[model samples]
Target: WNKLPLAVQTTESLAGSNLWDVPTSHLHPSTNFSSKLFWEPQCQTQLRHLQDRTRITATIPPRLDGHWVSSRCEVRAGPEFLTRSYIFYPTRLFKAFQHYYCDSNCHVPAYSLIIQGKLRLRQASWITHGATEAEHNLQKVTLVIHNQWAAHRLETRLPSSCLRLGSGVQLVPSKLYELFNAKAKRDCLGALHFSMMELDLLRLEIQYHPLHQPSKELFLGDVHTDQNQRAHYRPTGYQQPLQNTMHHIHPCPVCALMYQSSEQSPPILPPSWSIPLNLNGHWISQRCEARPAVLFLTRLFVFNEEHHTWEGTYHHYSDPMCNHRTFTLVASGHYARMEPSSKVQGATELVFKVIRAKVTMFEQTMLQMLNSSEEGSCGQAGGWEPGAEQDITWTAGCGMLGILLPHKEYELFKMEKDHKNRSLLLIGERPTDGSSPDRPVKRPTSFQTPMVQCSPDTAVPQHYSSRSDVSTGPEVSSAIIHHSVFSIFLIVN
Candidate 1:
């Protein structure tokens, strides 16, 4: 015991003092203490002597009670530097402390020591710091121990020296100091150096539960260091499954009716007149026109297959000179397929309704256009009257004939389906009526050339068209019926 280091002696003395002063009454409440026993000097002296004897006979080793994970390690020899990393799984360290009698004599006290499991090295590699002369000579070495096993026993006197023992030491040339005589010289290696080392462990957390289940356990937190000290356990690489549920699902009543109707009896038409499977989707025009000088036109069609109706909204825009004027003409109606006879063939009729036929225009454009009109017809003062500026609004009714009248029948045609590309082509045309000489000789055409399918919830652009003078009222202007060619892509929900 005296041969041990000074630090070891001091630690043993502290442990002895704690043990001698521990209250037996606190440990066992039923036991009573005598007043004389507490105040007697001889009893105190005996307790101190027993503590000293116990300290001399027992040795306390480093505590290895928790789980540990390897993080990083570095080794150096003079100017040479090497580093290694490890991914350690959660491991438990079990320790056993045993006391052995010094001799066969019954009066002899027992000496205590800690017994631990053997540590086996699994892999090793040598690495160089930079491009130096050692790089060529120090090749990375990997050792494989198949069936053979080797264990090296280490006996450390001081637990505080565990860090130095874990690393290794070697002998080298060094100078020794002499107290009384002159200085002496010797060859030795300095203590081992751990330039960088880290050990981490897992941390556990407790959660509240109203009814605790036998098979369930509270979740533990992730691996982290506290005050440069590691923990005991950590989670593995496997992760728990997440919980999720769909929340936003609104079933459309019209779509449900369409499905039922299709299932009852399929519409009979020519093989070429293939109706789109999913028509309850949005469509946008491919080409936009800037007719009427200031007005820019865009056309959009929204077809509700379940309702058997479609709404076409035409968006009109003016140049920046008119404060970027904008308006809309919405024409909504029901569509029915014509019987596939030789007389009518593949034709569809869009029966226009007067339910909500209206035209919206910008206030600025309406004031300017009305001021230049011929007679006082549309309103009290031929239009918006002077001093009634607040009475002027953006929307006006169709009055008599609707905006999309006299041309309702559209010839429906289909192009070859490109199954490889998952697209279908459709073409529709409103034939020339030869009603007005100002009307364009060419027919009005619209198409979904290669309509690619998309999700139903996608947003489609709005359409706008400027009203022709003929549709406004019986007072006709020589404005030609411009053919609008709308190209739209379809998406089904």
Candidate 2:
């Protein structure tokens, strides 16, 4: 290990110490422990496989707890390796609920809103009966789903659980609008609004949005069907009972009715590397016994939420007469076409390319923002004293949204203004997408000991504890909120 690349070896043994009460790391050319390590040729094979990209599709197998399980495959130069990775399905996550299978690869945007002011809804929950003035104030009602991936897309509505002021009396729609329009208090809002809301609210208004894509479009299909089929499935015609979870533009019920009445058939799959191999899709999965099951060699049908129907796709592998083709309805109603090994390989490549492109764009955007901020500061008359000015650029991928850029060799992020001391996470920038544009870089500066104050949202008693805690009752037009110092600071600074 010591004789290998310096960076690789250093990463391998970062836990041990060479001296008392202190840890030590050796350089690549260092001979201190060269003789102690032995290199193995067999390990190289496994390492190479680890570096290759493997694609896994989420599926429900009857053999398991119905949670999502993934079947992954990777093609190597010498031999092919197929593996099964366990995944937690979205539907199974909820208690006693049938969850919709969302496309893991699809970029679903989400956002969250934190209420910094007094919550009138808290008291409104007590009104479980008749329609009253509070129930009529629709403008004050705000129901936003806080999906972390996309924060900008928010839906204004009332949660079902909200206690109505009166039975059969609906709250005024205007109140819902006021809730979201409420001022940003202490920047405490970091919430998620799911993709479903974006599609339903904006599909008619905007040309395209994420939720508008039918589940079938993302499922097994050709390029033409994938691009244009979303329109065939309309939200207005769906028969499925509309619910918060059913925010996805639904499929046509007429098609679903036809599918329900049609004869059931088994899925025909492409060739498999070996016997007993498993194949799967976003919502379906199949396992073959001996010579890749012939049942999987033909056509398979999948449920389309957009058109409220079922659609079938044909899958084939070369074998002359195609005698290997056979269809088996292992499970009634839900079926997936057996995918060709070659097609699977192609899908994996496309997924990787999309992810890489998005990441690259994120990095570039962050760098530009950081550099622009610094340039604006440097353009000032004093130009910045040497070493007195500092800039740090960084990226935050977890707990927060959006990719961050490097600032002064370090990345920075502003946390949700809440109980946690509003400190920033500083991480150094590594290689991202490509080279960043040059800018007037600022030098690092020492900060005199600065006192940290608790943010207003955090200083006050914690309001939201869990998803269940959200109010579902009579509407409260507005809340009386104390002025948060941070809110003032953010505006003034």
In terms of lDDT, the best-performing candidate is 1
Residue ranges of candidate 2 with Cα displaced over 4 Å? 1-154, 157-493
Worst 10 residues of 2 by lDDT: 349-358
Task: Give the Å error, residue 427, model 1.
Answer: 5.4
| TM-score, candidate number 2 | 0.15
RMSD of each: 39.5, 30.0
In the range 1-493, model 2's lDDT, one tens digit per residue, is: 2322222111001222311111120011211111011112222232222222221111111111221111112111111121111121333221111111112111121211112111110110011110001111111223323232222222223332232335554433212222332343211112221111101110000012245642211111001111122322212111111111222224322222212221111111123222221111111111111111111112222222222222222222111111221111111111122232332121211000000001111122222332344333312222222212222111111111121221111111111111232321111111111121122121111110111221111111211111111112222221100011111101000
Q: For model 1, how does the per-residue alpha-carbon lDDT over 91-152 read when each residue is reduced to its tens digit?
A: 32222222122121111212222222222111110110000010011111111111111001
Error of 1 at 248 (Å): 41
Candidate with maximal TM-score: 1
